[model samples]
Target: MRLTPRIVPLLLLAAALLGAAPAAPHPVEAQAPQASWSWPLEPRPAVVHPFDPPERPWLSGHRGVDLAASAGATVRAPAPGTVVFVGWVVDRPVVTIDHGDGLRSSFEPVDSPLALGVEVEKETPLGTLEPAEVGHCAPAACLHWGVRRGDEYVDPLQFVEDRRPSVLLPWAGPP
Candidate 1:
């Protein structure tokens, strides 16, 4: 009844108006820069389609995501960055990196032999994955994965992981 600090913000505003649910769960401030990044698709590939961006800027969302991956797999380099671009677009095969300050990612149908400035690091590979009738995850095979900074369109799974938004915490067990 006397925890001080103004009674701890009125007991956190009466536990947010009595909804009360928070035994621990805070961290979630990374737009990019916490463990850098990874997972261009290796032992961890299965999103199928997410990142639905587009509130304006021409509409038709789905900015990026769609992991699955199988046709040719490989496709690495989720961090270090350099290979500015690789090829194709209107029909598939993309690639593109440039992870400097303005961060970029892009990977599409991918087939890259690793040209165009070439630097890469994080995972390296950066090729393969272009079979399933050239992307769009037709019968399966995926790997769209896109991220940008200069033009916007973020949420490449918030850089490798921690998509956040699952805070239940409040049941110490022994009920």
Candidate 2:
């Protein structure tokens, strides 16, 4: 049976709207939890140095992970959240995004254009990376990404996988 021209467009439109076509199903990779968010720097395997014995004798261990990236590289928010703090710490700007579930992501030496109370989306540019100072780091530029839950400082790398566009490296997954 031949279809009328008038009916053809309507059928096509309906199919498009309903997504009824047999298209290749996108791979069903497990979505990292909503609590899990993006990493600030361009995706790369993390280079972590164990916390020295003198650094924290009381705490369990090193509180955060250091991501290797160049200076002035864009830093993005890991998740959709509110900017709770944006200010200078020892003359270097720091921005903090609060995920509202006792989870917070923070960046140091940032040039933040966003102010406190501003809502940020996942992967939104929070600031640019700054040069690491002497004694703080050897000579390379890197982002010292950190996370805090309530009062306890935990490893930020543990919360989210590398969701950067160029690579898909598996992380330990969120805690």
Index of the highest-TM-score prediction? 2
**Weakest 10 consecutive residues, lDDT, candidate 2?**
48-57
- Per-residue lDDT tens digits of candidate 1, residues 18-40? 88664575554435444458788
Q: Please write out the lDDT profile of model 2 over residues 107-167, one tens digit for every residue.
A: 8767888988999999899988778773255487666667888977766755665434454
Q: How far does residue 105 in candidate 2 sit from its true spot (Å)?
A: 1.2
Q: What is the lDDT, from 0 to 100, of the residue 39 in candidate 2?
A: 63
What are the Cα lDDT values of the candidates? 0.82, 0.73
TM-score of each: 0.28, 0.63
> After aligning candidate 1 to the native by TM-score, how far in Å is the CA of 137 from where it should be?
1.6
